[model samples]
Target: MATWLTTFSYWLLIQSFVITIILLPLSHLLVSYLPLYLFNYRSHDSPSRYLLFITLFIPFTIIFLLITDLSHIVILLFFVWFSVLLGFIDHQTGYLPDLLVYPLLVLALLFHAMQSNEQLLLAIYGALVSYLIFWFIYGFFKLAIKRRGLAQGDIKLVAAYGAWLGVYILPYLMLLSACLGLLNYILLWIKIRYKPDKIAFGPALASAGIGLMLIKYFKEDWLIKIIL
Candidate 1:
């Protein structure tokens, strides 16, 4: 029985890896085409060249994530689609647009509703709670501390995560993001001749979102349960 299971798993992994490799060229095309398609980035020739290199690194990530199930693959598809869109937007302009966020919100709501009552509620609650928490924090900090440290983009990005991950998971995600973000900030300070404001929080938010998504799918409950 163990031998059979091992053989089946190996076969599945090979098939999925093959499919992902075949898709790499297509992903390359998307990375290149995304800049031109996004209107604002049609003029920039260099970033697309770099993005193609980034696309090449994407396959291993795809294969690693695919080791789990089809649902995760679908989630990754959506995540990649959104990430590409945002990447283009960020590359062209200095902002992550509301245009993508609105559509994502609609799609997420529709997707959850189609799934079931529990999912719909969880998604909605996640979005609402995350948004409000961030919003209040931003406002309070802005008033009392007299500083605008956290960007609204970060708030909306976390709100978007609400549609995908569990409500409880959002807090953990935020905590993880804070820790990692600080580490990244310090690394950037030491390595790059750039300031903190030069590096946008949107990328950090994207990384955090990806990290949470990966942990939710790949990490076993016992790992989190024991840690928590």
Candidate 2:
């Protein structure tokens, strides 16, 4: 069983890498037709080739390493792919289209449903909780500061992440995302010596989601063990 698992892991790694390489160029064409908001249409530009390659490669490698179950790996590969797409779109156009995010939410719910009834319930709860929390924050910022703290697309993105990862992990996701955002802000300030009025939060959130997923994947071996 151990040997078989190792062999399977290697095979998946190779296959995923090859697929990523093939899909990199094709992604440029696909990005053109993405459902972007009217305002974003003017800013629709492709991500750099290096950025695209890194995005595809990291998720594939992480998912392949962390998931022992083949079915779980397949589902996560889909999740990772779409998360990257959303991140790319947000980075490029500062918009997260419902066309992509809603389908991802549906897929995450379906994936959890296949796992068990309890998991499905947790996913639903996560989605609702995440959305409501963000909605509250949005309202608070609007009323208190007279500015939008988060875009609607960002709220939906977190909700989708909740559906995929479960409610229990939402806090960690948020914390990690905030940390990443702060780091990004600091880096930009240092490099450019000027802070932009707006920063795309989706990429940081997506990155946090991915990072937490990897932690969850290896929890049994390392995280849980350490905690216990």
Candidate 3:
């Protein structure tokens, strides 16, 4: 099994390079037009260059495949692809367009369905519960502060994550994302020496969700072995 896994890992790595090359141009186009068409948001004149973008995800894709099962590669790929795109868009424009988030939720439900009816049910419950919880937080915070504490897009994104990860993981997802956001806030404050009116939460949420998946699907101690 170890020998087969090692061989398969190498094969997958090569395939990932080919896949990333194909995905790069298409992803660039999607990022460029999707927001323009769907949300009337302007695309950046100078988006991150292709080389830099590829550099960001290549290591993540490698670690993702090394730990992921062959059976899950397709759905997980979509999850990562959509989440990364959403993260990038939000970071760039401060908008998580429904065009992306809704499809993300639907795909996650379909992915859960492929596992079992029970899993699908859990995903539904997870989505509903997560949405309500975040919605409440948004409402309460807004009432207290006379400003929107969380964007509607971020609330929906959290619900989509619950759909993907199931209800059992919602607390961990929220806690980790909060910690990440707080850390980001601290760094931004140090850099600018004042409280910024707003900071992007989408990136932190996306990173936390992916981080939880790595923990959930950890395959042996392969990463540790490589580090040593």
Candidate 4:
């Protein structure tokens, strides 16, 4: 058992390194070109390639080491990859392309569908309910603040999280994301000495979604205690 575990860990390390090398340039190209394709203009919001590589590598390695189930690892890694890419795009350009998000939503539903009927139902409910709730909030904030409080893309992103993680995680996801957003706002204020006009919230959503998924799967009592 020990030998098998050692071999598995070694191979995982090599595979993750190779995958990160391949994904780094690919990620760079996507972030650089996707904006031009979608909006007919280039964006300067692309994060540093080195930073992107590190971000991908760390998660890839950590997930590979933690998840023993091959199927779950594949699906979770794909989801994380998408989350990172979407987060970066939204962070840089303040836009979330439907091209990426719609596909992710469909994939999440399909994944749940394969699990069982009950799980599929939960995923569907999650998506629909989250969309409606966010839509109402968006409208209310737009009316109250005289400006759009959340983007349509953000609503879709939240719905995607519901579909991926299930309905039970929605409240925790929202709370964590809200806390992260406030921290982001405060940090930016301190750095710039004023409130910024906009915050790219998709990153916060993506991060919270990933964190909640980890907590859900690992069943870490101490982690859950800290989070809740």
Candidate 5:
């Protein structure tokens, strides 16, 4: 069984890599134009070349990590792809479209259901828990700071992540996201010599999600041990 899983994992890694390279350019184009079509406003001034590099880099990295285990490859890939998409969109426009996020949530739920009813319940609980946590944070920011701290899209993005990764991973995800976000802020500040008024949270969260998935892929036994 382990040998079969290893063989299948290698095959999936190769297949997913090829597919990612083929689809990435198209994904970039879609990310570029879709918002314009839907909102009649260009989400970004122009797509950054660096964005293209990061976009291609993440899935390749994730697929490489998954080559040792295929247990969650399909769902993980789906989550990675959409997370990348939504991250790009949110970074550019400060919006996470329902068109992408809703489908991701549905896919997570369906995939979890395929595994077991218990998993499906956990996914649902994860979604609600994460959403409520973010919602509370958002409300607190509004009341305390007299400004929106987290956007609705960000809340939904976290909820989608919870649906896919489950409640157990939420604390790690949040911590990673906060750390990455701070790092991003520092880099941007260093580059521009001023703090940017707005920082995008989606990229950090997406990155954290990918990191967690990689951990699950490569250290499933360790994770299980820790959880148990």
Candidate 6:
């Protein structure tokens, strides 16, 4: 058990930090291609070449070193991959695509079926509840503030997190993302002063999702200590 816990923690760290950097520019390329196809832009750079290299090369190295259960690792990768993918698009376009979001829900359902029989119901319930929460919050804040504090895209992102991580993790992902966003906003606000420059929420979302997956596998005492 201890051995599994330690390995899982290391895996979480890699997914949040190392895998994020590894996937960064490649996801950027995905945005480039899909956008061009959607809008027919001529000047976009090719993001395909890097796509092949990152997906193939990095996983090869990680699996080579880890030599653990492939099923477990693949499940972990599913959540992190979507988080990075969403983050990349949010940074570039300021909107999350319904195209991507729906497909991801399908993938989450697939993951739910294969890896998590017991957990699937709770996860789905979380998704629906969180989706409503964000939707309601979006409207109320818009009415009260007379300005959009968060976007529908962000609600979809939060809903996705809830779907994949379950109700218990819903709060953690939000709290973690908010903390990181607060820190980021303060720093960026100090420097840029409400310029509406496209900031990256993807990384925070990805980081928080990763934390959700890993925290449960640790010893409870350590988890509580970290929370404190």
Top candidate by TM-score: 4
RMSD for each of the candidates: 4.7, 2.8, 3.8, 2.9, 3.4, 5.5
Question: Candidate 1's C-alpha lDDT?
Answer: 0.62
- Highest lDDT scorer: 4
lDDT of 5 by residue, 1-228 (tens): 123244456555666568677767877886798778766657537677466656756666556544544545666666777888877877777777888889889988987898899999999999999999999999999999998989998899889889878998889888889999999889989999998998899889888877775565455555445842
Once fitted onto the true fold, the runs of candidate 5 whose alpha carbons sit more than 4 angstroms away are 1-14, 43-45, 48-54, 57-61, 64-72, 221-228
Model 2 worst lDDT run, 10 consecutive residues: 1-10
**True-vs-predicted CA distance for residue 103, candidate 1, Å:** 3.6
Each model's lDDT comes to: 0.62, 0.80, 0.79, 0.83, 0.78, 0.63
- Give the better candidate number (3 or 6) by TM-score: 3
Error of 5 at 52 (Å): 3.1
lDDT of 6 by residue, 142-187 (tens): 9997866678778887777788777876877878898987777678
Clashing pairs in 4: none
List model 4 lDDT by residue over 1-228, tens digit each: 112244467788888888889888888888788878897767755668987887778778767766777777777778778888898888878899898888778878877887899989999999998899899999999999888889999999999999987888889888999998888888989999999998989889988988877677655555465765
Error of 1 at 33 (Å): 8.3
Error of 1 at 75 (Å): 3.8
Clashes of each: 0, 0, 0, 0, 0, 1
TM-score of each candidate structure, all chains considered together: 0.69, 0.88, 0.84, 0.89, 0.84, 0.70
Task: Indicate the residue-level lDDT of 182 in model 6.
Answer: 74
Question: TM-score of the candidate numbered 5?
Answer: 0.84
Clashing residue pairs in candidate 3 (N, C-alpha, C atoms within 3 angstroms) = none
Indicate whether candidate 2 or candidate 3 has the larger lDDT: 2
